[model samples]
Target chain A: MFDSKQFEKDAAEIMARYDQKKAATLPLLHLVQEKIGYIPPEGEQWVSEKVGVAIVHIREVVSFYTMFRTKAIGKHHIQVCTNLPCVLRGAEQVMAYLKERLGIDAGQTTPDGKFTLSSVECLCACEIAPMCQVNDRYIGPLDRAAVDKLLQDCV
Target chain B: MASEMVLSKRLKNPGGAWFDAYVADGGYAAAKKVLTAMTPAQVIDEINKANLRGLGGAGFPTGKKWSFIPKDSPKPKYLVVNADEGEPGTFKDRYLLERDPHALIEGMLIAAYSIGCHKAYVYIRGEYIEPYRRFVRAIEEARKKGWIGEAVQGKWDWEVTVHRGAGAYICGEETALLSSLEGGKGFPRLKPPFPAISGLFASPTIVNNVETLCCVPPIIRNGAEWFAKIGTPKQGGTRLFSLSGHVEKPGLYEAPVSVTLRQLIEQQGGGVRGGKKLKAVVPGGISAKILTAAEIDVAMDFDSLTAAGTMAGSAGVIVMDESTCMVKALLTAAKFFAHESCGQCSPCREGPGRLYKIIQRVAAGQGRRQDLDVLLAVAGNMEGKTICVFADAAAWPIQSYIRKFRSEFEHHVETGTCELGHAYAHH
Candidate 1:
């Protein structure tokens, strides 16, 4: 499954930075996710072999973290901060708006596979409360208009 | 009184994150002074005299933490900067990383020199992509200026690598941070082999908070007595208090340790939002016990808040106004703990999840009369029984919210709905 020589070379560089091979699990998984958009079963097997760890252990690490997705996701991942601070500042209303806009509930992807909505705990951006992360960008203090504009821009 | 702004002095400056701007504002002068003139013991002594405590929730003294490193150990010592500011309602470290990245870099250099560490890793949270990029840029700038790479300043050898955390709140715990740094799950390790002795990569490591390290540069530049005199005698120096939720001006405020909660809410935070009456305050992060409206007159320092039955944990001041429902609030807090628990221990794993369910039921207007006592009992069992204080932190909001707002909880049970409606339950 691991055919790319460049991918193997990059994985080796990540392993060389750490003292133990087990320590390269997260970085390697992140690299795979970055390269392939999501961790497929083949990617997991690739990581298990690359890190020289058990496949089950690699799966456990992958499943434990929220960022690592086992399945394929939509083109855009919309993570709304629904933790306490955001909740106090009307995160629910924001989530409701996103649900209506996307025609999907939390943790569900749109039928078109355009956007996946998930409520997350504190993105540590409480200064601009009621915030959400659309892919790598942290956009905040969202209202109906802002979320609409965000959705429009996502396309 | 005007709040002192030592760490946040450059917050409002345009282009403050840039290396040249930071240098123009006297950024690495302290670092150069420490490396060129001061000994490791002298640097530690100055910080100890300043009485600066850890700003990452715990109030442990900074210099004493650095001193814990075994001087005679053969292993390459490590200094890990805990930039994983995951505590809810706390956002000060984000400001430090974004606005004043050079300050933290300078502080990291001083800390590395003090602990005899050649290589340091800044384990920043993955979510903080902007701050992470800003920090990495600052490090590169410093490298070009001959401040950070390979025999830093032509006298001592020091290098810094910025590592990103996947997504785990428990990694804010020092040992758990080390575990995550080694590319594993964020699980708290057993003590007696604390980070100072057996930390990242099985070496004597010192994990200091980003804000705690930022304070080091100032303490080295100015005399320790100057930093000591800024705050109370014991706590020493100003701190970044992140004020959010129900306040008119909800943002980060750098204040002295002697600043009262009332002053923070009214003076700094511009009072409650929409002219509403204050209902309650989580004086620190969610881990510290909630404070009633009547109790917010107390000082916000570590010792003062502790004496007032709360703590100065992370200084995350979360204010709630009169329209907020206590039961729903507790439910929100419970859900956070439930989700963030590393789950290595049974109590933390099961306790928060169960507590969250009970609170969820109670908030959804399906509560039993005995449920209140059950909440307290579950919280009691969870405290002090886990590998780390995560369970204890989870239990605190349960115990304190119930104790302080018993009537609000009773109202939820009797009315079969929240006083503030089910707005919080939409998620």
Candidate 2:
């Protein structure tokens, strides 16, 4: 199922950028995720086959960073930032509001799998203290009212 | 000047790291241009010509840092991406990594190729697990497509690894990152040997900020001349400022460093909450000295910020509107640094806690005039005396708050209670 020519082409380009294959952690991850919707549970082994490194090396990387999601999620992943700034600005209330409205706890997907909820740290829009990530896009300074409005708008 | 490109970069079909989506949006075209067209020296020279510096506090020239690696070094050279977005009041990296990890990856590939590194590491904060996972997953996709393995592009051998730090602020420092990569305590080391010349596993390394490296893909693709044209003199390119606090629409903004706080606040942030007037701003995070409402006209650049008596550290613009009690707000700020202190250095470990205690005393309606002087003395003594900037970071708000908001502080002491309403009384 894997296209070796395309693999060689992409690998050549990635190799041209760095001096060693191990340094391609984020790049390799990005390439894999972009190819597959999410990093396959066997991503480390898959990458090991692609990049020619020990699977453990890739495993250590997958285990270390939060950016790499091992589990499957709904079509849209929503993250609520409840860091100190957001918390100070009512991020907890926003999270709770989303929970009550969406009817799912953190890290749980909706029945239709259209949405998944998780608690993110912060999304830089601290001025709008409470923020969230709907997939890749940032939603912020979230209040209970704003969360309701955003949810309605998203649907 | 070019706009803040990172924040404004297209957030579109990332295509799961497939070559088509990346290529469709003009991805490796830049790397191909660099590898076949421009020599490594020429690429570095192009960056030097642009006059870009490290956006991460230190104004080190971008090209100079890259050039620190020897031309013919035998050992593995590395280009490490500093994705450890740990600085309080700073969260731009998370936004970039979350929304556009591909751009950073593209940039990393270009930087590694240009710097003669066949390997790269995106050293991220462990707490940022989700963001880190997305980034790593993206890289995996790149690897499966043969973009990260041996004979990449049919000739170059390169690899990228993601090293995650275990929730330590000091790990943001380059040496600490190297130590964490080596499975050691995340304490900073003296810098006779910088990371560029001697880094990770004693090999030459180029540890660039996530935002900084992310800028490279665009620069290389668009040309250094184009990047140079953006921002202001000496400060090339845009900055991603994380505007927080009591603003109407607080969020991230990517604008030229020339943009004033007022523009970022009034125009982008939708003004203060409930149309409240501005009080002061902790420009560039807690480490930066407080900027009074009167001093909000300063440009958000390295040189301009320094002249205005503050540093553009991480571009974390924490706006403080009126209704904020300077004493209590500062006490909160001091407490964060105190708690986050690594305790590796006494200046930070002991000083921030003591500063918090003093600020608490002042906030709790019990203070002395000498206490003000003691706060200044504490901050002054801590400066340039620690292994890392943590002590100085802990002390800056204390010293700067007292200097800029002396009247408010004196009012707290005079009234034996904060004059501001309940909002200021507690967090």
Q: Among these predicted structures, which one has the highest DockQ?
A: 1
Cα error, residue B302 of model 1, in Å, equals 0.8
Q: In order, what is each prediction's RMSD in angstroms? A: 1.5, 8.1
Q: Best candidate, lDDT-wise? A: 1
Candidate 1 chain B weakest ten by summed lDDT = B418-427
Candidate 2 docking DockQ? 0.14
- How would you encode candidate 2's per-residue C-alpha lDDT over B215-245 as one tens digit per residue? 7777887778877778676877888878777
Residues B105-204 of candidate 1 have per-residue lDDT tens digits of 8999999999999989898988888988888888888889888878787788887778888898999999898888886788889997988998988999
Model 1, stretches more than 4 Å misplaced? A1-3, B1-3, B423-426
lDDT assessment of candidate 2: 0.74
**Candidate 1 lDDT (Cα, 0 to 1):** 0.89
- Model 1 lDDT tens row, A17-102: 66667777888888888888889888888888877888887888888888898887889999999988889998999998899888
Backbone clashes in candidate 1 total 1
